[model samples]
Target chain A: MTKRGRSIRVPVLARVEGEGALEIDIAGNRITRLDLRIYEPPRLFEKFLEGRSYLEVPDMVARICGICPVAYQMSAVAAIEDAFGFTPGPELRAWRRLLYCGEWIESHALHIHLLAAPDVLGFESVLDMAQAWPEVVERGLRLQALGNRILAVLGGRSVHPVSVRPGGFSRLPGPEALDPLQEACRAALETARDLVAWTASLDLPRETQDFPCVALRHPHEYPMNEGRIAATTGLEIPVSEFEAHFEEYQVPHSTALHSRLAGRSYLVGPLARLNLNRDRLPPPVAEALAATGIAFPSHNSHFSIVARAVEIFLALSEAVRILDDPPPAAPALARPLQPRAAEGFGCTEAPRGILYHRYRFDADGRVQAARITPPTSQNQARMEEDARLALERFGLDRPDEELRRYAERVIRNYDPCISCATHFLRLKVNRR
Target chain B: MTTIRIIGLGSPFGADRIGLLAARRLAREVRLPPGVEVIERDRPGLRLLEDFTGARAVLLLDALAGGIPGRVREVERSALLARAAPLSSHALGVAEALALAEALGRLPEAVGLLGVETGPAPGPEDVDPVWVQALCLRVPVALERLVPDRRVAGCGGRIRSRR
Candidate 1:
């Protein structure tokens, strides 16, 4: 008698930021196929962006994902400014960096506490983890709030901020605003430090892969809104040169386009950023990283949590540094803009990873075309690779439920923003 | 510390804009009591806790899908969390946030989700006008329910009532 077709399926990927699924198939103790599917449906954000005024692009693109709206806004503003040959003054740039720090802290905190930690601790959800570790959950909430506080001060509110534009912000916060934000950050520093320590203490599973890592590289500081795209494989390219070397091809299984560099999958996000810029971290964060006893350039994706925690520490320190020297009380908005027909590219390191945006503008500054490549879409191919590798390493004969959970763990390790990967798919494993 | 926070939740696109529209209408049509703060949000998700923290009460207005078009429903937090799955595609949604708040003990003394049914409307304008009017009419009623002429200990030891 022949074994019938058997497969494992996760119809709805849970504990993730967006919608996705997973499926695997095995026959006679051998895994046949693994599909890391992201079927969230195409949002047509690129199409929607066309014909919109350049001024509205920042706010409009921010809606791409609630978790990292700032990333979209930052990339949009940068690209638009690039097209117009404008760069913000040092103070304005620092403010943008500070805002980016807030997003990192907030987004990373949410992932560490709510999404990833539960899997490491063997709980179903953060709510479940709270039952036994209330204090841990409380600290996470406080830290999350601290991150939001920074955004509220800088962006005007946490989500879909109304302040950003092509040239500069709508308004600049003065010393008075800076005082409270600084004070609040000061209070939260201890928690941020403790959170890093706590994350590092988790018994992380070690599964190292030799995949190439990529992120933004800046000479003087960690990359956020501005930097050259660097890869561990010794590839360095300006943001403008992104399309020249990399490609995003549509797969029938996913709404998101699978991205590759020189026709091969690469990893991005926290792990990649840390791998590329460990030495550039602030001294305090560097000290914290050393204390964790984890080696630098960790190949284990599980260490991504540590990368995020380290980022939170760095963001907090940077937030304090920026706040201490508040911008002048002069009007916060940048000089009036003069929009002209142009094409531009913007790339930034979101909390999750690198986000890229390209836009073409009509003579009147209306968007003629737009292309956005979110971090998650770039990570999709790598995620599928990891799932297959996990099954191979963990054993194909494991119980179906156990394998499913393990796959979910691997997927969540990337902290995928399925909404951002609107071009996502469902997962399925097929047995021969 | 603010005693009352009214948060209108939704995006600005299509039918999802109702929460924001209703919020703006309430802000203009009704006079807020001294301690109440009205805010508009584009899907704050788990950040709802941050918005509602330290408040004595919270009234969340949102455009709800999968119900009668233009119908309004006032739901208790407990009922909402009982089926605590995400209602939106973009974020964790209100139910999961409320559940997290409940588990963390950060919930206010009173919380209500004012759901305005979007029905089959394609866009903001397509939604029945009656839904908007109903939301406006229910704002005061919800406020009264939150405060209700009672002094509750969870309200930070302040004696509070609606004007």
Candidate 2:
């Protein structure tokens, strides 16, 4: 092969949420650079939070991501509540967990069946995939609807739910309301199981790499809205210490910030959660994972789809269990919140990974400072590293189109949410 | 639980708010049929599909990007279904949502869309009064189109171009 410099540019990546571009430079079989440019203009959500009352944070932040509004709401409210030293009663806590599960199932199903599966099945898009696998697509949509129903039941509506507030929900759902949701989850559980089996049957590439897996770890249950931040690198810290352990810095090529733990890239999201918290999975989910035969502690990021499928199974099952034991009806909002000068930190396992929120409030409870680290930004550095490693393993001499597709698959495996991260611009391939 | 559901789909940001403004004006200025209801939404996608269930007639109002700014147009459900193939970048497009609802057998008996043309997404300050007037002028006529037999009695409002 002649020694020549080459570059692969994906002007815009499809199937994943938000807008992003991938650029790879190769000089004579040696990879030179891989940049995942998230050129979407910064929405400046944190800055937008300034001067807004604490009561408005959840709704304002929920606008940050349409796909996972509940994640933003959960993390925002938890952090604000931490500032006020407030905790919902057991009933509200259980409902919060149930809401989180609904988000997980909905987000994971969308990624697995609609976004990521097309790349694995070698189709252009989910619509194309649906032609060959209509049943699978329908199942995914139905599951997604079920997840939305959960949000609707508890939060009042799917997108930007109205019920979730800082202390608790605006309204608590009664036992009778859970009947249809429970039945739906039962049916979804079966479909989710079949989904897990189907995804496992796919011959996904097995290329495991060593990276720090970061997520929240609870004492006895799967991490949802509460836990200390834990990493496979023997690092554990309270959510309050997140600012010290992790930092987000920006690059000129992308508008979104890249995150690092102790000046080094790390990983989060489904792969991290599954690897770090396998012990916390419910019995049925554990059984399903075992049945897949894909070993735990999977390094091959491609198995993320499989991991997501397992989570869908877990979420539907969890929803059923939550509904089976309904919380007694209680007022959604706690007593009138009193504003004080305090700072609080909140970290929760979003559908993608660990989402961190910190807030500083004045005596009036107006926001003085706000910091949010979405999972996508946290994974940006790691995603770039994965791209470099994948290119090296796949061969630099691969055709541009092949390389582009490979890069897309590698990025989609992380399921980046550029929309939820910074915002959208456009992706263009400047093939020089 | 009205048989005739009128939804205004929009975001509060800039020109996107035209749909919401039109729907609000209609709800206030017009005395709609006995079983008619009007709603304002911030941003809607597939969720709009579920709103179609059990309705005898449905009329949607939204802002259309990539056209003459402030221009109003009436789009039919069939046309929306025809163009639903390529999904939009933001969540789900209206055409795709309608198509999905149709596929799931949830579309109502009569459905229509009335919208104003908008430019590139503007900030909050870009709520064009001209665009608001354009859509408002067409809402009552659009509603009549959706519910042909129903007596919708609120046509003599301030902005009565009827186009």
Candidate 3:
């Protein structure tokens, strides 16, 4: 029985790395409502973060999700160092960026080859992709494994890593350790460039949007670990005022709180980063963008897969370059922390997008309050709004599995980490 | 290496951690005798495989979600053995790690699985059910194969050989 205009939902979303659901309300021809509900059980990371020592913050936040633990670690340290009013030296900072690049290369490849491309090409999962496109999946796996290898080299444990501390690393990695990664990054970057070109030409639904894009910006380099916050609409603010402009509230359909700016929602992460930082992208990547003549910004979330691939290219190149100039030593971060009273905010560009962490420590050095805003939660509202717009523009003629597939794809694009979204994803209807 | 231990698997926080719950209930209610260790893990990952090696007998308690929901079923640990590369971040899932160990000629004398089926969308509170308790009886039921004696109390811990 071919059922038309019926919306579908998957209890667990795969590929983009966390758990989430897709809700589409289709009534005959016109689509009434569409929502990508992220119901990954709320761990309330930020609220739970209160009263923990600075040392424990990194460990506690890492458990927020398995997919992007490094993102959590980077953001936490940034916050910690900011709170203590210290900046990392050049060599140390380069290592941080290198680690982030590994994450980006690995994560982007996972999304491109395994998740997004499969959806476009009509495969159930990466498992299925392996049977059909063996080489592509193999390359993807090798790339992912290499990233894990990089993580294992630096972080101690690839998944939850114990290597990162306050000022820099517990110990600087040896040059020999960084050599193999450099070679892998070089190969992976070339592969990623080819992959991006292939994905950009795929027939996606024609849904260009006008999103209020936000991302980290650096005048000298592309934003990965450190940068000032900037938006497409010319709203630049210090990371400290993050909470002042943004608000998070829980929605009826989900436990996660959706975030918005001054009552209006904004988009973050890959698409936003690509649009806002197109200039900062490496020359080859910039040229790739130019060849497409994608003059303006991208609003189509489907193109997110393309953006991820391009990022993989940039990340691979950047990582190799950083590794080439190995730091003098893994800086000495073996500081015995003391109790302190202060407030600090830190923002880092995680693989998925902007990750922000803020903390207020008491005299005893215990965290009085801790707040984390990961990329997925920040993109929740934008995802739902994207769905509504897609329904209106694409014409909801979802027959049978098509509706479910479309919704799943939308959630997959943000790679909604419902686990992290648990801390955020506030939804409320505005009848303006 | 002379003694053997059986550990249950499942997570209490995860929606389908009931298998571990049942295994824990048995040991607590009926004290496990000497030379036999009963342990529980969220899931027997690669790390658990190392701990399980050289054991005479091992049993894993984990929930499997098939078409059947809330059905307590028992099978050999080998029955669930599906070999794939350890693609997960974990060193191994129970099935593959054990199979790999076996292929490397370090197989345990006896291995078993007590898979409890759970619902599509289970919650943290899905452990307490009449079916779950009834499923717990499978350990004793499975012990029937190992020990011929109908004696319910001792469940024959130090069996001589493969009965």
Candidate 4:
């Protein structure tokens, strides 16, 4: 007796951020081939940066992903500032960190609710989830709005904010502006804390696998705007040395590039960040996670929602802490930068994971060349690897719809901003 | 108290900006009712739902794909919902946002949408100024029809009530 070959094709994947497809081939109960096909046209952002003035890079990159515009802006400015040998003041740095916190909250909230929660809660869409869990959905929306408010205060608008510049912000909010934000964060803290427990209490699938986690690790704080790139495999490298350790390459099936750490697929984003930087969390956030009784350094990819929830708590707490001290009225921008010819690298912990940017500037301060490795691209390989392991563990013999749903759940777990990566999934399963 | 909120949703890219252009023009040219407000947003996504809060009626202006370029028409909520299969959460369009708003019970009593057809393959610079001006001239009339009682006072005899 021989097994018959069958193919299950999903033309488009829903409940994600961009257009993509997934194809899996199983042979005799084994996933012989899996491709997370990203059919969204390549955005060509890196190439667009070439020959543009360095001043425009921040705004240009910000257009890459609306959900994490601050990440792109921060990374671009960090790289450009490094090229110019400029360092912002403590106040400016704090503001940047605060801005990054806004992005994390907004991005994570959207993912946890609109994208991932429906899957976890066994709803077809967020609309369905909202009908059953209105309060939960409202909380997510409220938190998301708060994040946008913070971004609007700093960046001047929530979407593709225009206020960030190299060295410091182009504009700074008055001290009065911080008052409402501080109060809002304070109000949201309890909600964020509850979110952690809520996500933990969800009926999440429990499948742990051995995969190295990678994220930025700061000695004093949970990694956000600044840190060394560190991985669970004991690899630590400065942003400048990222190329020496991490590699990105194209696959035939996808338009987005897949990245590897030291020649192997590795995890990035919330789960990886939590696993690697659990110690760096604030005491309150750390205590909240501890209360969940789910230990960190968690190998379960499904726990990424929990990680996001915990980080939401961390972001709110950090927002409160940062806003507690009103920024003194000073020149919002540092001393103007002089055009220089140099190479610079910037790595910031985006909501998803470490976003790395490298730039070569001409003497005229034009971007001679540029490369941006977004978190989604970095996590692509790991997502595929996770999907294969997860589907195998899930039993490939299950009904095609069940297999497809399970695979989608595994991929959506990462909350891959397929738009950011030119990225992510329609599902096709071929069984033999 | 802005009871009627007209949100023009678009990006600066090509024909996609028709909504924004219409809204801005409407704000400048049309003397809207006391409780009416017009504003532009650039690809607000789920954030669009926020525009519905505290408003009794919400009218959304956007660029529609297919059909003759510059053809303006009223888009029903059902039609929007029917076409909205969001590929990504970040790319949640007007339809999904409205659906979510309805789901969360935040949808206003009266919701309406006006679309300016952008034709196929709209590029970064493909918007026609003639269509934009036409949208500006015709939208107020559509607004009158949609809201019924609201009278648009500006533009003298150029704008007439479809009623």
Candidate 5:
């Protein structure tokens, strides 16, 4: 018995959402071991937010991840607003929903067109894909740009745009500022329809997985800003009861904390949402998704690209509707947080999936403990399993080039954002 | 005869990856007296080390995007080693693929830095005005170090913040 090839391990991965690794033991059968670790140090916003002024929660906890800054902002604002006990006015809610739409559009497009699509199309990186499938890459850039444009119009620059506070936005976008967004949203809706159709047209392998679906469930609309945590197995609970239902276990083999529902593991994000609330999707978006020939409860993880494309259409359609009647000028926030020892739960549908944050603030505002559960962290285990499943399904006898793409596909489904400690995405600073 | 390899970090299309562009300009100005090689390796790989073997020194240039905007980190090999393992795997990023070189102890003797700060702007792909400006100031320093008495005019906008 000979110990085959060298064992390689990545303790921390780059160009991703959080830390993860790939280790392979190639004997007769290549042991493709992939662990999507969430290496982000726990800041414990939940314990820290125990007694602090609730208002400071947004700014303080927003540092969790750059990719979904607004998600954090929205969750903190909504929860704190819930505690202080006031719902944002109808107009404010519409504006908040609009901002969320931009995040979904941008993040979903990024995952689909840039990260995942390249892998499916037989390219190592998007840069490689750009040479052969120029049109596809262009479409991604255009769609991503549209998403970015929406963020900029409402908030500022797409990455960590400054807008949306507890009560509302920092400063409401002027009517004209929203006008171009309206136009862009209208055009993007059509673009998204085409994108979804195009994505469905790809030859996707099928798998039948019975993983429990986890997502926020809304009565009237698709989940985004607020809803109870619901499972496809008929389990529904408030976000505060999240811990009661799910537990995060620390594994020495990986950086990310693995999550499980009580005694079982579950899946979330795009697939989960579509499965749970396909009927709630807007008419146009739903029709576009159906046109893609994809159905709900799609166990094939690769179908996430189709799910993302469908969400992009929903985002565009929603954005246009919001822009049709912009929220009037109003102070971005409400009264400063009232300080009292308390625990508050916040959750939102990030572009990737459900991002949960719990803030326990001391009487003043010093963060006592913060638990920021990013969507990527939750998806880590599933990603690793997907990689192994892909290898087993495809047979490791195939070339690394072909197998590697599917490996990347598993990772892309989580839309891993390696920087969960910091709340921004795709930041490149140039000081000349 | 020493060889220098300039591997571009970050997505070239991204608003980062300007470090590669700066390294390219420096490679043009600081030609070896006789036996020297320049390589613009894109992305990450183990083959990048083939250029620096038996060389007196190597300068790895790339982009860094963090902190108070216009700040440069003159990182030493040791500083990078603390981040990486066995000192050799720190070629590109420690968190990425490195254990291959670390076990071999095949690290270059001398390593230099030409890291340029990119402050939330468009990065260098074909060419960018912002990256070219920073390179103008840093390129001369690089050439002076590699080839003494060699001089080259800086191009890209009027030079300022020359650190």
Candidate 6:
């Protein structure tokens, strides 16, 4: 009997955020080659930012990804503010945190319910999953809407929000808006807690692997909009020093650049954040997570779903806390800005992971150059590494369909925002 | 409380703005009944479900690719569901949103979609003003067809274009 080599190809990945495919080469149970191909055309947002006024940076960068526009805006504003040596007062900082909480809730809820759940629940998509578990779907949408409501109250609209600027928000919400949002957040706390328990209870795959976890870590709070870059590999640095430690380079198979921490693929996003900042969780969120009995510092990437659920709980609680002290009618904007020629860097924990931005501005405050590193691209190398290892552990002798499904589940665990990464999960297998 | 929602699902870019434009015109020109609310959304995605919830009925105005530009027609629920190919979670379209709503049993008892045809790769320049005027004129008649119990004021034959 002759052993024949066959290639299987999935033209487009489903349920992700952008265009990408996967190709695996196998020779007699040995995985020879694996490439997580990110084929989406590179959107040159950074290039477009050159020569734009500092004021336009936040809005322009927000157009990068619909799901996490606030992340872009937050990072952009933070960078620009840093450039001008402007530190927002306590009031502005609190509101910015609340706004970021809204984004975390929205993006995490959408991913946990719509994108990642179907794979674990043995369904083709969220629509099919909705047929079997309507209550679950409804809860997700409700929580997600609450998140969007928060964004609308602060940023003016959820998708590509507009109120963010270098100094502060364009207009602050009054008690009329804050009161209801606070009430909603308080009500949703219980729902978010249940979601954490529910996600933990799922019969998730137990394939754990060794990887370095990376995320922002703050001394007093769970990291979101501000923190020092920290990793499980005993690396800690300011956001300004990110480029010195992390390197992003292109590979032949992907349009998105692959990132490495000290030349090693590292993990980012929910799992990484949870691993690094579990000690910083608020008491209620900490208690809820403890109740799940899923220990933090988890290496299993599948636990990302539970991590997201936990963050949703944290985000809702944070929103409640912030809204309790609504913004004063004095003014939302900071003192008039005086721009100077300088360079600045900002790194925030985007829903997927750390989103970094660096800008070089001229004396007149126009951007001389810009660099943006979204989370998905940072996770690309790690995703490819995970796929190769996870597939081998799952056994290479399985049918192509099973292998493909397993491989996709691995990639989706990252919740890769392909549009953000130039990102992906079309599966192709070449077997001999 | 608004029992019927007329949502325009589109963005500010190019021909995609048609639904939003029409929605604005509807709110300004048409004298709708007390319970009918006209609103415009910029690519509401799954957020469209919120517009459907608690409403007795919903009418969605959107731009459809293919066919003659500015041609207005009814899009059936089945067709919308059939088009629910959610390629990416980020690109969740109206069809997927509607299907999810139906699946969760949250969709309104009465729902109708009115799509204005925008040819492939439509740009801002491709949006014809005359065609938009014609489309806007027929919207009230379409609304009457969708909800028979309500009559839209200023929908008479002698209606003049305010533009």
Predicted structure with the largest DockQ when compared to the true one:
6
Better of 1 and 4 by lDDT: 4
- Candidate 2 docking class: incorrect
Off by over 4 Å in 3: A1-28, A40-43, A330-332, A337-339, A418-432, B1-163
Q: Report the C-alpha lDDT of model 2 over B95-154, residue by residue, as the tens digit.
A: 877775665566786889988877553323466676777777776687778777766746
Best by lDDT: 6
Cα lDDT, all candidates: 0.78, 0.78, 0.67, 0.80, 0.62, 0.81
* Residue lDDT tens for model 6, A329-408: 35556455779999999999999999999999999899998988888888999988999999998999998888877887
Q: Which ranges of candidate 2 are over 4 A from the true structure? A: A1-18, A39-43, A419-432, B1-8, B12-42, B49-59, B66-70, B76-91, B98-112, B118-163
Question: Between prediction 5 and prediction 6, which has the larger lDDT?
Answer: 6
State the weakest 10-residue window (summed lDDT) of model 3 chain B. B154-163
User: What number of backbone clashes does candidate 2 have, counting pairs of residues 3 or more apart or in separate chains?
Assistant: 1
Tell me which of candidates 5 and 6 scores higher on TM-score. Answer: 6
Looking at model 5, residue B19 earns an lDDT score of 62
Comparing 2 and 4 on lDDT, the stronger one:
4
Candidate 4, B1-163: lDDT as tens digits: 6488889888766678888977887787667668888889888877888888798877788888788777877886667667656425655678878888888889875787888887775333466766667666666666576667767544323433333
Model 6 reaches an interface RMSD of 12.2
Query: DockQ values for all predictions?
Result: 0.22, 0.14, 0.05, 0.36, 0.04, 0.37
lDDT for B71 in candidate 6 is 81
Worst 10 residues of 3 chain A by lDDT: A1-10
Candidate 1 per-residue lDDT over residues B50-105, each given as its tens digit: 88667988989888876787788999867877967522224467887888788778
Model 5: per-residue lDDT, tens digit, B61-139?
6665554354554555656545542111112242222222332344554555556665553332343545545654664
- In candidate 1, stretches whose alpha carbon ends up further than 4 angstroms from where it belongs are A1-18, A27-30, A39-43, A329-332, A337-341, A419-427, B1-42, B51-62, B86-89, B108-116, B121-163
Candidate 2 residue A83 Cα shift, in angstroms, is: 2.0
lDDT of 5 by residue, A1-432 (tens): 111100001111232334344554445554534444445533343544554555556754554554566787888777666654456777777878888888787767656765676657866444456567767755765676677667777776565566666666766668678777788678766678898889899877675555777889988888899999998889999898988888898877665688888666677888889888898998888888777766677877778878888888887888888788766666334445465556667788987788887766555644566677777767767766676666776777776555554555555566666421111222111111
Question: What are the runs in model 6 whose C-alpha is more than 4 Å off?
Answer: A1-17, A39-43, A327-331, A419-424, B148-159
Candidate 6 yields a Cα-based lDDT of 0.81
